[model samples]
Each structure stands twice: as structure tokens, then as C-alpha cells.
Target: MNYPKFRKSAELFGVICGGLLISMPAIPQAVAQESTPKINPCPRIFYEEPHNNQVVVPQGCPPNALTQRLAAQGLLPVPATPSQEQTNLGVGGETPQPSVKLPRPASGDQTQQPSPGAVSSDQPPLLQPRQTPSATIALANGTVNIKLVNDTATNVTFQVIGDTAPRSLAGKSDVTLQGLKAPVTVTFEREDGGQLIVTPQASSEPGNLNVTFNEATNAAQGRSAMRVEPNGSVFLN
Candidate 1:
């Protein structure tokens, strides 16, 4: 064969072998599959107290041999056992006391203890019954003063005075009834009063302040109003 022909044949053979090697499937890389770490469910043994004969076990011990032994000897609370969910969550397992032993009084002692159900009359009466506040409305300088009958430590809150009223007032003292062109209704709340004080604002304009007092919601037993006279005397009644 000619030299050029021989060289071409050799190159063709090499290409075929290379293609076969490239097409072959590859071997998988080796990897170590890790197992999940195991958690020890048992309680630590180091908590055993030899002096008190107490044992602290892992949280979820059943009411079996160990618990029964501790209870029988009065080392643990009687009838106290861990719930199933608590056991699953891992809580509870400590023996605190062996038992409570009550000592008897001396034989010749002439003292008597009151029965458990007895109450002593000498004890001071409970703090005076809380008094309910009476409600009254006082108006000054575009501000309204809701005087409660009783002194309350709590802050007073108020709502606009109608069944369709919105929440508009809340303060420690003296709520400002704003946006008043004519008259508006107001409801007062006392910290101790069961009733609400419902009164209509005396309108500067005729038919402007037409409001009804809801006795059910009125903390004040009576209907009251605040008005400013030309003499500058403010009548709050």
C-alpha cells in the first residue's frame, strides 16, 4: 500500500476505538451512607442521691416497677404520674422527699387546734365592698367631665351616645367631645358602676342635640346634662 493510504487507515481505526470508549457507561463514585444518630431515652444515672435515697430517671418512665417503688415508700407524690404526651415530650422524673411524717403533740399539753373548716371572727373584715360610681356630665371649654360617683383606680372610657354610636372617647379624665356643630350624644363608663350614663349634649342650635338615655347602658341612675349659661355658670345636672 502507498504511505498516505496506510496512514489514513491507522487514523480511522483510532477514531472508532475512541468513540466506543466514550459511549460506554461510567462507574458510580463510592459514597458512605450515614445512619441517623440515636438519642438515648434513658435518664442520666449520675442524679442518684444516696443520702436521700432519691433517684432521678429519664423523663418518660412508665408507672411501673421503679415509680411504684418510689410511691410505695412515700418518696414521690402519690397518684402523680406523667401523661402520655408528656412522656413523649420527655418531662418529669424526680423523687424529692421520702415522705412527710407529722409529729404528735406532747401528752400533757392542754392546747387545741382549730378544725380545718373553722373560720376566726377576730380576723379583720375584707376591704370595704367596692362602691359603684354615679355618673354625671360636666361641660367646660369644649371639654366634658364625666364625674363618677365612686373613685376608681381605673381609667374611664366613653362612647358616642347612640345605639349606632362609634367608639370615640377614652382617657384618664376629661374627654374632649370634638366636631360638635349642634349637639351629640355621649355615654360614660365608670370603673365600678354597672349602669352607663347616657345624656345628650345641649346643642347651641335648635333640634341639634336630640339624644335618648339608655337606662340599660346608663351608669347614672338619672338623666343628666351639662349646659353653659350666659352668666358663665356651667350647670352639670
Candidate 2:
């Protein structure tokens, strides 16, 4: 516990350290080397899209400490989607094909097909072209005779292309429309009240078209619609 005892202890400690230094195994220079970052992960896999620009995280690997530290520095996901309207038109991609207007509910504006062997316009789906019924007819011939007979007891007014004027037939009355052309479409609308079954027999040569009105159709109720095809085939909806 005295100064001499401490001095002796220090001398003995220095001697023991010197001996250990001479006998101990040498530490190679490898301890000073640093390891590269595991950014690529082991087995190195990557995904180009959807996963963004970052490499895939290897399974069983420790959490990415550097990535967690700089998570905000990665690319923002907001810019990936297109924003400009023109780009959305798919400028570099195939232009989106236009979708035809399928028959909507209660859209009565439907045209009928022309006569047999008649070149009809582009028709609706499952039908020929939209008939060019919206035309003005010339009464060059003496008269196109169309016998209009109303089976139901309801007055109905009828009109179509190539018609000089709209004609009205009384309820349950049979009338012949004279001085008309062939391939004339007759559209009927109920005048008095209730449903009217107006049938037109083209009692003359050539073919005539009859357009069916699809108005006030209620799906909940048992109401139906009529579709005229390019072949003049009528379909009840």
C-alpha cells in the first residue's frame, strides 16, 4: 500500500505486458477492411416496373438500414400514372376503338330495313346499316299503294321517308295509302289511347319497311320493344 509497493506493481505489469506482446499471435491487416453495402441483396434480383426502381428485397436478409434511413428519397409513386388528357387518348398506344351505341332503354328512334335485295346503310348490331329512311321521295310513279289496317281499336298517325305528308288512320279502320313509293317506312304513334296494332301489308310490288316505336317501355312492367334488322326481320323486345 506504500509508494514503493505501487512502483513495484507497475514495473511487474509493464514486464508482463511486454512478454505478452512478444508471444501473442499477430492480427493481420484484414481487420481494417470494410464490407460493401448489401444494396443489391444476395442472389441479386430486380424488377423493372410496378416494383419501382428498387431491387427486390432478398428473403431472410436483414432489414435495409440505409433504405429505412432514406425512404423518402425513393421515386414518388404519383408520377407513374398519366395525367394529360391527350396522353390518355393513348397517343403511343392503339387508339381505343369506338363503341357503337347499343339500344338504350326507351330510345324509340330506330329505323327499319329496306326491301329485299335493297342495299341498306350500315345497320345496328345484328342488323344492316342504318337505313337511309330520312329521305325525300319523288312521286314519279302513279302511286305506291300501302294497305294500312289497324287491328286494335286505337287511332294512330303514321309517317315515313318518301312521304308527301303524314297520314292518320282511324281506329279499327282499313285504309289504302295511294300515290306513294316502294320501300316506304311507316311509323305509327297511338292517337286516341292504349296500344294499337298497326299492320301494313305492302300489297304492291317491291318491299316496304315498317318502323316499330319503342316508347314508354317499362322493364318492371311486361312491356316489350321491337327491333327491325337489315333483313327486314322484326324482333320483339
Candidate 3:
């Protein structure tokens, strides 16, 4: 070959190699920029305490809705001390909340429970007081004639128990029970809501008794007037 032609071709090859070497660094730099990931900035942040002189930083951010709701409810996390600055803080999912404690009752504030068999003061008594007879007339040993007069508005029932059968005397009527035994037990009950006020008048003729059932009096004066003596004699009113 010719020397001048050889020298010109060699210079052209060097220019091409120099241009390729310069463009090689730019191509790799463009490829590296396209492959690299973009970093997103966190809107919220949380700090982690240092342990063993090492602290870990987290890339994730805390939730906005949960933090705001807790703040409205007065349940936020405590902050660090003002003297110390927090560094390399981490963003965690959970937030530290304050613990709630209820107040305990004092010893004097405790309630006293009533006993099982205790009775209330406002309740009425279970048994009523026994009544006393207005008057009593003792019968003689022989047989007697007795008369019962009902002066009430309703019908009255009188029984000369075991001496004779029971009899029902109408309202404003009279009944005569004759030849009854001396120790007779007589019971009277009204048909409606009224008690019999018996008043007795003993005859001086030896063996006659007049018993009258008047209108209903008060309950304190005794509903009836009769008693049985220990000597087998019956006193009636």
C-alpha cells in the first residue's frame, strides 16, 4: 500500500473510536437514571426510642384518619422530652395510647345491705288486736227462750251451734229460738259488708233472753258481745 493513504485511514479510525468512547459513558448514565426508583416523601412521621445506641428509621408514614380521630377523642400519644431532640425516627402503624383507669370506691362509700329476715317499718302488722265484749249476760242452768232481732240493712245468719240448726233472719226481722240448751254458742254473720252490734236484755222471769243485732258500729267497740264462762254457762249480748 501507499503511505499517505494509510496515514489518513488511521486518523479517521482514531476519530471514530474517540467519539464512541465519549458516547459510551452518556448511554450508561441515561440507562442508570431510567432504572432507578423515585422516593416518595412521607406526610406523617413517628419516632422510635433509641436502644443500645441504635435507632431504626422507617420509610412508611402513619395513617391520617386514625391519628386525627384519636386526637379528637383526647387519646393521643405522649411526646418526647423537650430537652432532648428525636432523631432517626420511624413511622409505625400503631400509635401509643394512654391507659384508662376507673376510680376505686372508698371504704365509707360502700353500701350496706339489709339482712334476709329484716322487716320494713312502713309495712302493716300481720295480726290485729283482739276485741273485748261490750257486755255479757250469764245464762241459768235450765233451758231458756231466746229471741234475736236483726236491725241491720242486710240479711243476718245466726247459729245456735249444736243446740239447734242455724237460721237466717232477714233484714229488719226478728227470730225466736226456744228451748235452747244453757251453754249455747251462737255465731252471727252479715250477708253484705257490715258487722253485727249485739245488745242483750235479760228478762227477770227466769229463762228468757232478748238479743238484738243493731246497726254496724265502729270496729273498736267490738263486733259482737258474748263469752263462754268456765262453768259451762254461755253469756250473750
**RMSD of each candidate?**
25.1, 22.9, 24.7
Candidates' lDDT values, in order?
Answer: 0.44, 0.44, 0.61
Q: Which ten residues in a row have the lowest lDDT in candidate 3?
A: 79-88
- Model 2 agreement with the true structure over 54-90: per-residue lDDT tens digits: 4433343322333333444662222223334424343
Off by over 4 Å in 1: 1-151, 162-171, 195-237
Best by lDDT: 3
Model 3 per-residue lDDT at 230: 31
| Candidate with the greatest TM-score versus the true structure | 3
The alpha-carbon lDDT assigned to residue 164 of candidate 1 equals: 32
By how many angstroms RMSD does model 2 differ from the true structure? 22.9
Q: Write model 1 residue lDDT over 198-220, tens digit each, in one string.
A: 44443454323323333334334
Off by over 4 Å in 2: 1-144, 200-237
Report clash pairs, candidate 2.
121-129, 122-129, 122-130, 123-128, 123-129, 123-130, 143-179, 144-180
For residues 1-237, write the lDDT of model 3, one tens digit per residue. 699999999999999999999999999899999998543332123233232123222223332444444546776553223211112232222233558897877998877766789987778989986545433444556566778888877898777767656668998989887776655567887867577777767666556767788776666543543544434344544
- Per-candidate TM equals 0.19, 0.27, 0.38
For model 3, the stretches where C-alpha displacement exceeds 4 angstroms are 1-141, 222-237
